[model samples]
Target: MTTVIEVQNLTKRYKDKRALDNVSLSLEEGAIYGLLGRNGAGKTTLMSILTAQNFASSGEVRVFGEQPYENARVLDRVCFVRESQKYPDDAYPRHAFKAASLFFRNWDQGLADQLIEQFQLPMKQTIKKLSRGQLSAVGVIIGLASRADLTFFDEPYLGLDAVARQIFYDRLLEDYAEHPRTIILSSHLIDEVANLIEKVIVIDNGRILLDDDTDAVRDRAVTVVGDAEKVDAWASGREVLHRESLGRVASITVLGGVSADERAEITASGLDLAPVSLQQLIVRLTQKAESATKVIAVKEGVR
Candidate 1:
């Protein structure tokens, strides 16, 4: 696999807030990545810097083994379709496609036409007059059809309904299977794209929390359900990400993989084990990080 993107100690600051803090990661040429994080967790900021739409405050970033800022060679191979993508008020969908055709060397008009028709986008209407869902369809179409070596889809399902979103996901996976390229998907709908992405990069508080294969991430944690007393006893010395209790029943999610023996022991102890979904794991991880930060802040304040 070829390294297409490399970042070393990348940091971005705005005013007093640090959007990206010493982030370092590398991406290979042919894999779909899910850039998962909460709102304001630096997902957009990082993407902006990678695509040359924004500058990093400090540290180095290399796309295609070269700087992306003001570098047309690197920029031409990258497609960034963000929720807040802007266009001329008078520009129609066709104009956007025409411009994209000129920019992306691998632009596929056939795919773009299929998407537009499936999305039922109004070609004659000005971009500004299109509804939110229609506007999102335009971005989705462009992102999928551009066939850029590296494409970023930042919340591309903005106003799309469940069915429409499914279409986007289906087409994305189908296209990716045929055309192997690096794709970075930034979305809040984790479970929806969990199966699509090969790798997962989780960002929280401007820091890289988890960057690993999707299958490995799935095995990071497991949940146990049983009587409150038994559940607590089992989770006593373990890292518990989350816990819920209802009457005499309790459910506890803990960090660490369960071995075959451990699974047998858990079941024999009258506890049922449940698999944690990617969305659930991420939510717990972010909450845990936030709590730790609060504790650290309190400790500093005491000093």
Candidate 2:
């Protein structure tokens, strides 16, 4: 497959702090990628740069083998649906679709109309009057209808109820099956999109922490449960990820897929092996404590 997007040593800085720290990544065509990170971890910054909505401090960004900025050829094939997408205060749902038709080359009015009805979106109501869920429906409609070669959906499900969110994903998957394209989804709701994303890109502290296929990531770790002492002993020296204990029982997660011999050994020891959830793995990998300097300063100021 062709590489649809490429970034090399991309860095973005604001004042004295770096928002993106020399990050580099490549995206393959016709794949769904999950762009995930903690808040303030630069996920938005990275997406903004990729979509040419914001300038990069220093780096290389290439879409379709050419620079994307001000290049209609490259820009026309991309659509970015973000949570903070601004609209005129008096703009209604229909107005947004009208504008989308003007921008996206592959815009499908029929699909947009279908989505509007499916979500029960208010066509005449001003965007500001709609609930957060309705606002999300507006974006979701445009994102799917645009059907651009590359679509970036940045937290497009926020404020959407579980049922509404499911509708969005189900429609996305169904549409994508018939019309395959490269999709980049940046969301805090990982588990919901876990099954949808073919590739995963995890960012932490302005850097790419993990980039791997979904199955490979899942295989990277497994959890074992049994007696605390036995579990700890078996987990010792292994790449232990996260652990939990209750009474005399303990659960320990460790990195890397278990080998056949190892699994036999675990079973022989009478311990149970359980599959680890993707959300749990990501949380453990991206864990961070509050800044110490801020804590110290707050104490000093209070004193």
Runs of candidate 2 with Cα error greater than 4 angstroms are 288-303
Model 1 TM-score (2 dp): 0.99
The top-ranked prediction according to TM-score is: 1
Q: For model 2, what is the alpha-carbon lDDT of residue 120?
A: 93
TM-scores of the models, in the order given: 0.99, 0.94
Model 2 steric clash pairs: none
Candidate 2's displacement at residue 105, Å, is 1.3
* Residue 271's lDDT in candidate 1: 97
The residue pairs that clash in candidate 1, if any, are none
lDDT of 1 by residue, 45-153 (tens): 9999999999999999999999999999999999999989999988999999999999999999999999998999999899999999999999999999999999999
